[model samples]
Target chain A: MTRLVVLSAGLGVPSSTTLLADRLAAAVVRRLGGEAEGRVEVERVELRRLAHPLADRLTTGFAGEELAAALEAVHGADALVAVTPVYAASYSGLFKTFVDVLDRDALEGTPVVVAATGGTPRHSMVLDHALRPLFAHLRAVVAPTGVFAATDDFGDAGLDDRVERAAGELVALLSGTATTRTRPTEDERLADPTPFEELLRRAGAGPTG
Target chain B: MQLGIFSVGDVTTDPTTGRTPTEHERIRAQVAIALKAEEIGLDVVALGQHHNPPFVASAPTTTLAWIGAQTRRILLSTATTLITTTDPVRIAEDYATLQHLTGGRVDLMMGRGNTGPVYPWFGKDIREGINLAVENYALLHRLWREDVVDWQGRFRTPLQGFTATPRPLDGVAPFVWHGSIRSPEIAEQAAYYGDGFFHNHIFWPPEHAAQMVRLYRERFEHYGHGRADQAYVGLGGQFFMRKDSQAAVREFRPYFDNAPVYGHGPSLEDFTSQTPLTVGSPQQVLERTLGFREHVGDYQRQLFLVDHAGLPLKTVLEQLDLLGEILPDLRAGFAEGRPAHVPDAPTHAALVAARADQEVPA
Candidate 1:
């Protein structure tokens, strides 16, 4: 089954960032589920509820129960929808902090749909300059059509088409139309680890004892 | 089971009194604490090693030796001895000297020290922590067992025709435990050598501890040392107990809130739930500690961090007294329904006998 996770870094109770994320997630689900070969599950991670825990993790050097599960879900998903409000021409600190706390290899080669909400369209470059580069560093495959919804664009009719385009790109990737695949996940590596002898050899410390 | 206390040896101001112990006082307090452990019949006394300030465990062997000279039966160990930055030759020589001075009551845990600048300060890099641990420990393992050593490795200068002085006591090295917060490589290293695996159970969630221990045990069995259940495992914990659970909470809350590494992050309530920071009556502490075996299975060595975050030395003494009170029952609980085949933690005598057993005239 394909798992799609949505991380909405909107601080408000009814923030436009979350609205854009929900629209994109729904669009991907609709297209992926329509296929006979596809069975998809969706999980939404609201970053607001996890704000304190994220800060706590920064200080504590470990994730709490709720934050850990959220991280696990995001890492496990076949596709991800990450939306954040643009702040000072960048993704919100809350969004960036969440990404920073995730394991470096957490999103490797996972198809990600990047979205943003800002007060004006000028801040929309956050998708290219901030979000895409961030996920790129994580080795994730950012969907080509990024959906950016400014406050005015959310009121306009053009937002829906961008969401649809972005979702279609994500669905295509999830359908394996794109060859950007993943290395073994952390769980896979842990469950079937390299033999200690091999690791010792790599470290140049053989079993001389 | 070997019940003990492993102190990080941090110097923090007591929030209630707003007074911090001087390094001299803290040092003396730790020595006194270890002596008390021997007096009260606790099995082990371990200290952490840190190169940075606010932590006085930078020279564990010095402190442990001082304590060892005054005590007889109590085992001396480290919460961790930094295997990465410290030269293997030094670890071999120093710990071997300690083994002699302590009269065979010495063991140590290998750890990759965490503080970022500490690596570069020691002419090493943090990125090479796992490598340094593996390579250095390999050299240390050989140095302890072999009469002469010739070695070359990535992180250190090569050694040739060198012998570690004062070879291990009775030709038996102190037992080693590898400690890691979450690194699987360290766990695998521990398994590769059939060493004890120690998980610091107070910082992260219990599930994380269980996962690390599970990997170590499975790899231990894979390495053909013994059954998975028979592998040596040590866990670290924290507690603040009083006769009344509420009083325990009341007394420990300030220290918990401002403690380093995790302070000012999660509330005490949430932190207690996430990690093994049990602050309650002695009964609750015992039950919660005993509950650890449910997940990690029967294991050897249970160490508690009792003297950090500026809890006064007096309170720490009281905590040890309480720990001593429950240790017999805790030992019984750990020993209950135990398989006869599982081995207790190896002591010097046991290692000597095992060594003698391996040598037959055939």
Candidate 2:
């Protein structure tokens, strides 16, 4: 029942990044093949047209009808791929704001592949210094093969290759076939187990009266 | 500690020199500032979003995405990405894609934005600005974390079973800093979700910034994210540096007088004295910046306004050189001096390490 989730944070109706996400999902589907024992569903969440802001106020809890399903999908997904347009040398505010809404561990141990589309090839570094740290904070296992395509880099064939390669890479990571450097070194990921269970117990306790 | 240089990208005439830089020149200067930030070993370089006369960064994402391609070690961030007016769905998809391209070196600061007229231009109500921000961010949050969203509410159409494309890199969404100048409500919102609180402390005095940060920290702990000290914090600042403090003031005078955002407001000297603006030498700049920790506590990110008021590209590049030479040492020194109780960058390794440590028996 492993599910692949594609989260698109792009502008423009016909986006290069969305296409990339689709191609990624397809590659995962292809890799999973019949080996997928349960329903291997592919889901996409377009952010631009959403109704409410991701950050909550005093009245709102992490619950709203619009967000309930999305939260469920995230909690349920076995793998995730997030794509955004680099803004101000980082992921878009829209993208980050969305992340702000989730529990800190929403992506804990999940595999992710970051992708971006821009006007030039100069901004590829945002993947490592800006976006990676945020996800790293959430404890997501990122895919080493992140994809960046500039306006100039995209034509018919090159664009296809970029999308296919990113999709293929995510599939490899999800299927445990690809070596994902986006993750912490095994020892690092294996941080002390005591603190984690305390965290769980504390979380279970909730806000005590 | 996240250190960055932010650019306003203003094209203006230097009143003393009687020369005006073209918009293209201004944009180039902003780029140079970013490169200088990297050369100086700063952690990040952020660009502000402004679509009006005198400002050149109409497409902040385009510019930052370009910067992402060039830098290696510096994290990229946005001073403000409009959540109220800009479509959250587009923001989600675009940034998710960017995350993949950049190898995960990204995050952003969200704002309701300053320009009021911008609301109606996007066919929105300015009066409902706060509501727009609240609703839009809520949906945007869901989109990044979830895959199949059946969303229905105001602002956008209902979705039966909609899926946003190009999921977030590794299923984790980007980190966010909610930037606010006067709104405690925004601070409260950031706290409620355990997100970072960015008090763009440029215009405000220390007391106000301290109060805002305090509120955010208290609420963050209340929400069970972590302790008050662990709450993420980023502050905004303005700086103009030269070897000589007096010379720096003399050179920056014309730009300060005529600059759009601060032009004809408080005297630049008075503004710097009262606010976070530090107009002085590199050593003075470092000393003044490190002082921010006094009020804000162990902060997460610090961004400086370096390119604005129509400063020439060459002059800005020189400033960057000075910043680059001084800032790396300052960052290391600052980190070394930080209290052990302060939280560091919330990295995956750190999170896993902390989790593992928590799991181990005493």
| DockQ (Cα-based) for each candidate | 0.47, 0.01
Q: Tell me the tens digit of each residue's lDDT in model 1 across B194-310.
A: 999999878888888888899999999999999999999999999999999999999899898988777788899988888888999999999999999887998999998889888
* CA lDDT, candidate 1, residue A194: 70
TM-score of chain B of each: 0.98, 0.92
- After TM-score superposition, the amount by which residue B138's alpha carbon in candidate 1 deviates from its true location, in angstroms, is 0.8
Output the number of the lDDT-best candidate.
Answer: 1
Docking class of 2: incorrect
Residue A89 C-alpha lDDT in model 2? 89
**Weakest 10 consecutive residues, lDDT, candidate 2 chain B?**
B344-353
Per-residue accuracy of model 2 over A1-209 as CA lDDT, tens digit each: 55777888877789877776676777667766633555467778776654342432111222334555676577556788888888888888878877877656667878888888777889988878887888889888787777787887666577666666766666666677232323332223222122322432432343333
DockQ of 1: 0.47
Q: Which parts of model 2 have CA positions greater than 4 angstroms off?
A: A1-209, B347-362
